[model samples]
Target: MLKGSAILEKATGKDGTQSNHSAGKLLMIIECLADKSEPVRLMDISKELKMNSSTVLRFLTALVDNGYAKQEPETARYSLTYKICTLGSKVSSHIGIKDVARPYMTELSMLFGEVVCLAVEQDREVIYIDIVQSSTKMLRSMQRIGHIAPLHCTAIGKLLLLNYTDEQLDHVIADKGLTKFTESTITTKEQLVEELQSIRWNGYAYDDEKCEIGARCIAFPLYDVEGKVIAGVSVTGPTARMSIKQIQLKLQPALQIIGRLRKELGYTG
Candidate 1:
């Protein structure tokens, strides 16, 4: 077997030690499949992953057999399968950081009668990792774990953005370019920078009709071992039930849970 250290030097890392332990090549293939606006062929996957066609074929065969990929027989194109989605949902539900939050999330939604969600900052946007829907007849988009959202609009997005260092934030802003979704969404880079600072000091962030009209949300960060923000937990709902005072009053419980879950996440800080 190849020594781990030898491979570590070749893998890329953001912190300088090229120590990415993930299945980088396979992940690259997955990325290509996701990046395409539509399903891709084996040749496209092979080219994107920069691997030999035969090697790519073997990988796809295994992935398809394992239910990670689905292939159209006539077209020979591959796409993500529902099984992969099921596995993703299962993993998100059982992740260490989210495990303790599940019970709390359930209670929080019930308490506020709103939608509770956990979001993580991935790449340049926010990815909904977990969500607890309160009312059965709620009027909002059904957010799945893999669904992506704008980083400058949602309450959780602001809270998660507050966790990043100034330099990191700059990089993200440069990449994502402060694209505005709704009219109320933060459009200026300067204003967003200011909001991030406020979020850090307040220990919470607010989204008043930014993500979706008539939806108001409040969010706070979930920290990790070093007091580093790993993800954000938030509650959102219709403006009628999500009034400012109600959101403020409900903030403490979420903040309290945030405190407990932070410790549970091994945050010594």
Candidate 2:
């Protein structure tokens, strides 16, 4: 059986120099496979990639051995396995999200004169990945990138819970224990469920001094290419400036920007 190590060894040149030719070819083959919906014949792959039949077979054999691809039993055509999607998901979870949202976060922070944050859920907790500080010198919420906040008491956190089932919500509450940060924090499972329903209807979430006294936030969901909520973007500030009245006033423009962002992310719904 062909091995990845052997492929790498073969990629070395006679002058004892390593080249990325084989790796590039492998990527081309993978892209070719991904472009097609059905399993592809070996000759088709070789023709499309302009590679030798034997060379393509070697790479395909290596890919099959490594579980990245599989061959159909009857037709002997090749197709990618779910392992490729798993790897892509892992990469997608970490990269591009921050880069894509940073400009929008900056725009919101500048417009609202408050902190704008981009966060995603990890292990049932909200993790702030990027934060754009307020443009103004006024007092704002002290939210830092990489800060972990409870899902039950944060705008972005609660917005991220839109897809959770009742059982999943119960599991989260049981494990995370809905620790009350303020009197406004939802401590009971029933209250949290009701709050989620309201968020679903409202199409956004509010943090009315729930996580910290005198702090307020409004959050909207950020979708992925497939229209799935991958993360959330929120604007947070002191209650004096981010009061309910002010939030209601700024909601339309904020949502407009968020809608543009969603479209940029390929979310149609």
Candidate 3:
């Protein structure tokens, strides 16, 4: 509910102290940019923050240099960068999912003898929050914490996207452009929708070397207390070791684990 200048003012700190002036100003500029739905001009930021144009330009330059903000040359307007969202997501996933899912991920790795991953959706991309290496290490995957995979191809990504409404799904797919990572990747909206229907009916999803050439992944959705899909739990390995039959067999145990995990997260449904 906060507006541009108010956001800037509050970023100055709770005590309204000038001790951390530079840091506060930087945060203020970020908040001001974040408050806007689109890029804002230098004069707008300066006027909103009650700061001089020169000071605003200096802060903007610093922010742009640090990859936190970008400027449009023709428009001369500044906007927050994807870097802010990426950093925020990393911090959030580290603080939230990793600690809670670590034991479960470890158990999955031991049981399946394959890599276990915990991930959540962000901007239609799946970001792995935690990973447990395979015990055998013979069929390990390339996924790691903070790795981003397309929502239409990866198992966890599809699991997360399955919960989206049709309109939302279409928007995400349009924005992300379904870049094919492998021959098996779903490149058409119709194909993806059909796959999503199957995922819903099966209560799980499979990558089937769709994200990478020789990797296979099976993922189950994790729900929050509200029965909202909050994240996904997946197992990954080489396709040779995780063939279609093998993935189908692993789906049951994965479902059981996800059911317990959902309950642990207070999911009533």
Give per-model TM-scores. 0.64, 0.68, 0.68
For candidate 3, give the lDDT: 0.79
State residue 10's C-alpha deviation in candidate 2, in Å.
Answer: 33
Order of candidates by lDDT, top first? 2, 3, 1
**Per-residue lDDT tens digits of candidate 3, residues 46-104?**
99999888878877876676677899999989999998897886576446766777888
lDDT of 1 by residue, 1-269 (tens): 22333332323222233234235655677778777777898887887677877756655665676667788988999887776676575356448656788887887788788788888876668888788888653746645688898788888888777666779877888778777767888988788988888887787888888778788888878876566677888888888888999877877776777677777767766
Off by over 4 Å in 1: 1-94, 135-137
For all candidates in order, the CA lDDT equals: 0.74, 0.83, 0.79
What local lDDT does model 1 show for residue 189? 75
Estimate the Cα RMSD of every predicted model relative to the unseen true structure.
13.8, 7.4, 9.3
Q: How does model 1 fare in lDDT? A: 0.74
Candidate 1 has a TM-score of 0.64
Q: What does the lDDT read for residue 260 in candidate 3?
A: 73
Per-residue CA lDDT of model 2 for 1-269, tens digit only, reads 43455654543321223335677777888899999999999999999888999888877877887788999999999999998897788568657878777888888887788888899888789998888887674554557778888989998888878868888888888889989888888898888888988988998899888898998888999877666678999988888878888888878988888988887777888
